[model samples]
Target: MPPTRVGAMRRRGLFVSGAIQRMRHGPAPGRWILLIGVSLVLGVALRWCGLPAGFLLGPMIAAIALSVAGGAVAVPRVPFQLSQAVIGCLIARTITLPILTEIGAQWPVFLGGVFSVIAVSLIIGWLLTKWQVLPGPTAIWGVSPGAAVAMTLMSSAYGADARLVAFMQYTRVVIVASAASILAAVLAPSADGGGAGSWWPSSVAGRGGTLLVVAVGFVVARLLRTPAGPLLAAIVIAALAQDLLGLKLELPLPLLAVSFAFVGWGIGMRFTRSTLSHAVRALPAVIASILILVLVCGGIAVLLVVFAGVAPLTAYLATSPGGADTVAIIASSTHVDVAYIMAMQLARFFAVMLTGPFLARMLTRWSGYHAADRA
Candidate 1:
């Protein structure tokens, strides 16, 4: 062979050897770089397209694709925990004094709405479990109307399949967000055009305080070693500090993006070929259950309108089953009672967080009993 041909052949052999080595030893650091790059591109695209939780969803989808294709890469434990803590803080920051005051003024109405939505979700989850649509408490967690990311993280702690739960949760988020946006447009067409605020923190002290809170939460979670401990701890600490101490919690856009990417990658990289196949098969049942929950919540909204005398649009948005962030966006743009809507959303969120584990255990026991009876 000519010198040029020999060099080309040698280069090709080296490439093949490297490929084989990577397969045996798992992906290289370059795989991580590639994953991050792809995740960023997709995240930005999805966000531009107006998908709720697009950044997280984009990374998750990218990770799933890579994992299923055998390019599996795992997020580091520390980063994942910190990301969870950041997400917890994000949730806590939503609970402002205005939202709390709204809930306080009509505690009964808020209580009714919260429990009503929770009860409906439980019923739908139970039906899915009884029908054997998904395994164990996965269906229950999947159908829970809490914040999608929070539910997905907490579900893993309860021994449910996080991959499946993530799938179900995000699917519902997309549907609910889209439906809510459409309804808002139709019902309140005149009320549009609220722009997003700045993504950067206004003051260094606020950012530092928020980081300090996250650190404390990280330590507490490390000591507790509970499932999703970081997330739960951060939420409690940040919420109390914000609501009671009048401290401002600030999370810059870059910090949030990184944290969301970490979470998205962590969950996504865990998906195996079997898991992906299982999720595909379960999609129909999941969609049906989500729709049922949405419809039931709509009925609850009607009750709010008739009895509580909330505006029709506000009631609908407030009683939305999932996608609190998306609902907030719509509520902000529209001429709805934003405070009341957020209050109801936050109320349902806290209620789910408190009762989720108990409900999971109950569902597990009930599933076992039902299975035994059938056997």
Candidate 2:
């Protein structure tokens, strides 16, 4: 096969692997419906049982992680991972200049988190490659502060092994989120530390409408092929629209829980038997590469917090190199600066998108693999 064709074939496997995973792990079609229905029921029960606010994503993430660990369900496949690319693309429509200005205006808080994580991800990638734990391209992309899904997709697009990318991306996020949540619980500044944290709008329905708007905006953004930056942007715009229109957005708590459950289900679908069995033959290196990246990026976040003397907790929350939106949600429950987290997350995202391919090329040259091998 031509090198390009080889690349394409590997790229195609990203989706194929996921389907095969489902076939092996998932129930028959009739059972799948029953499982999904049960999931919805459980999600609703959890939401109604007085889970803390802004924690809908937590349950879903837990479901995905638990399923993978306990073997209750198949690991998600590449197609499901690819589906998030569409979500990212559609979410691009959320951007507006006002939203940029909103976050950019908080320059000091934003820049601290952004540069800190970038420096960390870069240094970590270099170290893993030096240690021979990972191929350079895999290490570079693995440590990036961008969206987990985005990193995986870009890696696939560049002809990196789809299974490795998916595993590393999801694993990093799982570690980062779990660790951050625990740390924040133990060490977060008392809720009353500052002026009682600013009051969030009480209108749940209005908020849900904003989410609807964001979802709609994403569709348009994807159709336009706009970059993914706007997913948060669209949320901001919708928030603005809600305020301007004085529309009180009321979100049903149970409904919110189900929404995130779907997202988790989708995320879980990224891995399967193939992803673990054949695909993970090379995972020892990949896992080592990721652990090193975490330590490095995490250290940067700690340093940034100390240097900035910002609320170490808030700065730390904002600085961790996880997904923009996911991090923002975590910060919300912990009462960190939601805008700051969102901003820093976006900065890291653009950083990964712009640099992932170049990193892939550099690693290929250094590691004895042809760049063309990265499909």
Candidate 3:
């Protein structure tokens, strides 16, 4: 009775399906252009607003939105690895002989503070798992108070959901950075006078050397096949070169922006609807854990004030569970002892980077054992 109508309907359905498929996979150039444009706009806006890691966060947010809306575009592996290496080099540039000496002078204080943060992170991770908020070691890595990018990449390497880890890491970074900035304003309003330097490098030689180090680091990481090997290798090599050989490592603004975009896109494009939903649901617990950490670290800061005789702001900045880069900015903008805060932050960074993987594994196992016992 309706053969022609049915045939026409079938062809229309096929046409719609083909169009959807083409949109997702065939329009590569258009998708890239759109994604890059959106990323740039957001990145610039956020940077202008003075948010921490604004470039990275902007691209991340853009990618997440596009991904959830079915316009996802993937970042290639080589670019992502290069991005990680670049970030590693950036971290390395901050590790100078003076920072090392400072840490060495107060080894006990550094040790206690760094371990206290790590232990609290472990406890939070364990509780997340016990509460069944995230699966396995993902919770452990998510709550680790390390360099956010480092934690996210390392967690992905260890088979945790990088998307979720990135969510947790960046969320805490934003919160902690904001809190530190507020505290800085409240404590020393007169000291907030520092501005960022020029984005271009002063020396071409330094930039070349930095690139060479990153290339070597990439190769070494490939050889080692370790989790986040590229990043770790770059950090070690660049730090050695900078501190021991007195080489200046420079990461220009443009280069850093592209690298940050690659990393942000890499994490953002991996999100599926399911992961996004999980992240949304787990966000409350994540925020709660972060607040608890901040409070506990504040208590630690008070101890530093009383016993170590450090300035309150310096102590707080040093102990704040945010990214080292963000903390450095806050320290610089305020009248706090920038070197001391950085030293403390770097000490904690190294400690977390060295022990994070082992702790994640141990906690995962421990959590699993408890789950089995309950069963």
Candidate 4:
């Protein structure tokens, strides 16, 4: 046991400990760092390309490509979709009763004082089952054309398939939104603004209000656990408030559109790649459900022209059963009765959300359907 032997043992022990530590930690543990770097580079590239006005249709197509290329992400269902109803109804300050009340006045002029349009919706809804087009409740919700999120919630509650309902609605949105410009271009009378609608809640919030609302919305959205819905709601609401006051915010359109894209990405990521893959196989059924909806709602619009004495074009946009933002924009640009269109649309949205679930439960004949998960 000499000093030289003791030094040799100590050196061996040090080597052993170092080797074990290296084994535990491994190399390149910062995977997310690399992902962030790549995402950042992509973002900058996108911003710099200078996409032409109303050129978002291309970018959206690109995003879909990226999501598919990135591969399917599998995980438990996320929580935020459930919160969309709450976020839609309450997060935005502009969804006030005053605006809604004013919008309601047009229902008489459009739906008839006897609620003929809604009655039509109900009858059309029943026929969907007759045609084997959709689950009864979902058909009703699909044809409803109200608030998409609200309808989703109602379907969830009444025991319809929330995911299917959401997927169907989202599909229709993509279809209408994707084709909006094309349709407008084809259908627009040259003298009538060429079917290019004005941005609704036309007042853009100035720098100060925009920043303030963005900050407040970010904080509240984080706190409320409504990741995307609240933030988007903030943009919509604050801008709306500014418009109502006649001092609109003047933020650049590109910035707002980008914000919307990010929000959409977050929501799109919720259903793991697998959920969407399954949805892909079921695309025919999903597409069928939405087609039925478009037909029924479109028919309702045509009938309103006859029964309520509203113009066919005006009622067509009003009853188009598309997204609130999309329809709102159409109404504003076309100089349609924005108030009435929004009122009926919003009510339908809420109706779909709150009541869709129970109605789904009432349909007991479906083979794979359920009452609780509602999806």
Candidate 5:
């Protein structure tokens, strides 16, 4: 073509090549930094918009996107424990003498509801095993409707596949969390704009006392090796101090948001390609099982609302098939009775811990017996 046109094209090519080379050798930001920075920005934006569980959900979604895009990222266990401590302390603040009395008064309803949910879980577990949807012991442990960590830990002792148990448990957690956030939005859409934590406490005595309580809780939890030890210890200690010493402790909203982000990161970072593939393959069966559990729990909640005259929100939160700390966070966000919901979850947690192993072993025997009969 023309000489001037050819020179222009050559210059354009050189410019493009220079840009590519710079990109290859440039001081680009680390992938981890980009991932974290992006997640924080998106999460805070969502929180500002007043979405239900926005901080947690926003970070979780961002992390999931990065993980799927092959980003090398990880969340340490210490952050997970710290997140639990933040939530645990928040929940403990909601407990009171009146709420404790209410729980005692409603003991019959609470016990019946807990037992019914366990029975439903057991039946679902059997169906999954019977249909070969999941392995017998994994199904048994997975469908226990207890704390995921506790159930996963219990699975090994009962000869269940820990990996499968963990997979199922976390699946339920994700589903329940997503559903609860949607429900919270539908039920309570208003923003609550108070109670941010301060770096400096209002009083020196208050700061010292609260710090002492938290320190003791962590130390005690570590010694015990309890599942979710930090949370359990914090809740128990904070609750006792509130009742006995009339002490009140509060975490600033900013700190609480950070804890939520940490928790979301911990969960999302667990989603490797292999795990994601297996989850997709098993999605239909797992979704069906979890949906059935949710429906059954919802029916129980409705019954409590009608027969026991409990508040609808309280009933629903009480029977929610998520973790206790999760239930507390959702309940608090929705302005519900955190103590009552927590009480119900605590009851279920203890019951599962007590009966899960025995039941899993029994189910294993039943499965073997049935297989032998078929043979």
Candidate 6:
């Protein structure tokens, strides 16, 4: 109320404002502030709209808009890594002994389905090259039905257009994830079996045990040079501990939201007008290939339903063409048979990761195309 008090309050306010500006601007002020502020605001707004995976969608859209506008923005790796770990934890919690037993019993069916998916994906790739929609290697890598990021990273080495491949791969992820979520909402409203909770253990001993498992997982995944390292590690550790050791670990809702936001932002930030224009030009071919793959995989799902005796939703999930990470999230959110879907997705992922390079080379050579050496 007095002059001294008012002066002091003003000084304090200025100090706080300066600190915030420093944080928002980082080393470079104006653009970074805009990027962070817009992303945060949009992410929250999307979450408020009750959108499934709104946290991801909002930030992603914001990042894409900024990128297209030629704004300099990048989501650092730490947020993305934390997100991966959170998702890994969420996925690990879904695995259980009963699910493992069920999957083990149906190994024959899984084998058949995995083979079918690979065979069909290759066919789609061939079709793209035949139509001259893309180059041979790009077509192959673009339509590989593997994890988007992994496949994209491998694309250049295999003589594919890495930018084009990334565009195609991530676009399909967005489409498939959106469509699957919508379908689940409409057809299986009760599928979501999870809700918010803290993953921390109650006692110090429990906390130590949980951390130990996660740390071990992180180390193992890194050692193996796995893509999405922390996530894969977390999933492996969580699942083994839960199923074998009867341990329970979970990620809280807020943490899950933040992770989703980071992953979404990471994908969206890859876009620019040049890359997007290229993607649009190739959209017709890409969409056709994806459609064919989905339909063929749908047939595989039918077999899963009839022979494996799982629900139609579960069958469809097991055979979803891409987005293994997204599939796990959808499975958990919709409460579809998590174990079965994850098992099938994992089967396809490993198959593609282990054999994708060799197969790409073979197919290119067989088609009378030489694989390019960029390294």
Segments of candidate 1 deviating more than 4 angstroms: 1-28, 91-94, 129-142, 147-202, 243-246, 279-281, 302-375
TM-scores, one per candidate: 0.69, 0.67, 0.71, 0.57, 0.85, 0.82
Q: Taking the tens digit of each residue's C-alpha lDDT, what string does model 2 give over 1-375?
A: 799999999988977767545643566553355346555565445334332222333444544544554334542443333333323322232333465676667677567667767766666665665554554366666667666776777676665565666776766665666566566656652242111122353766755665566566555555665344345445554555554665444434333333444455655555555556643655776566556666666666676667655566666666666565445434544545555555567776776677667865665556555554433
Give candidate 1's TM-score. Answer: 0.69
lDDT of 1 at 373: 40
RMSD (Å) per prediction: 6.8, 12.3, 8.0, 13.2, 5.5, 7.1
- By TM-score, rank the candidates, best first: 5, 6, 3, 1, 2, 4
lDDT of 3 by residue, 218-284 (tens): 9998888765567668878998999889888887767777877887787577666755676987788
**lDDT tens digits, residues 56-170, model 1?**
6678778877777777876799988897787677667766777667668888988898899998888888777777778777898998886676788888777677889887876
Q: Model 2, 289: alpha-carbon shift in Å?
A: 3.6
Residue 312 error, candidate 2, Å: 2.3
lDDT of 6: 0.73
lDDT of model 6 at residue 257? 64
Candidate scoring better on TM-score of 2 and 6: 6
User: Model 4: per-residue lDDT, tens digit, 34-98?
Assistant: 32333445444533432211223333343343344443222122322322222222223344456
Q: 1 or 6: which has the higher TM-score?
A: 6
Tens digit per residue, CA lDDT, model 6, 318-357: 8888677777666666657877888788888889989899
Q: How many residue pairs clash in each candidate?
A: 0, 28, 0, 22, 2, 3
Q: After superposition, how far is residue 125 of candidate 6 from its true place, in Å?
A: 0.2
Error of 3 at 265 (Å): 2.6
Q: Rate the local accuracy (lDDT) of all candidates.
A: 0.75, 0.54, 0.75, 0.48, 0.75, 0.73
Query: For candidate 5, lDDT tens digit of each residue in 72-173?
Result: 366777767767777777788888999899889988998998999899989888777767777556787887785788898778766666767777787777
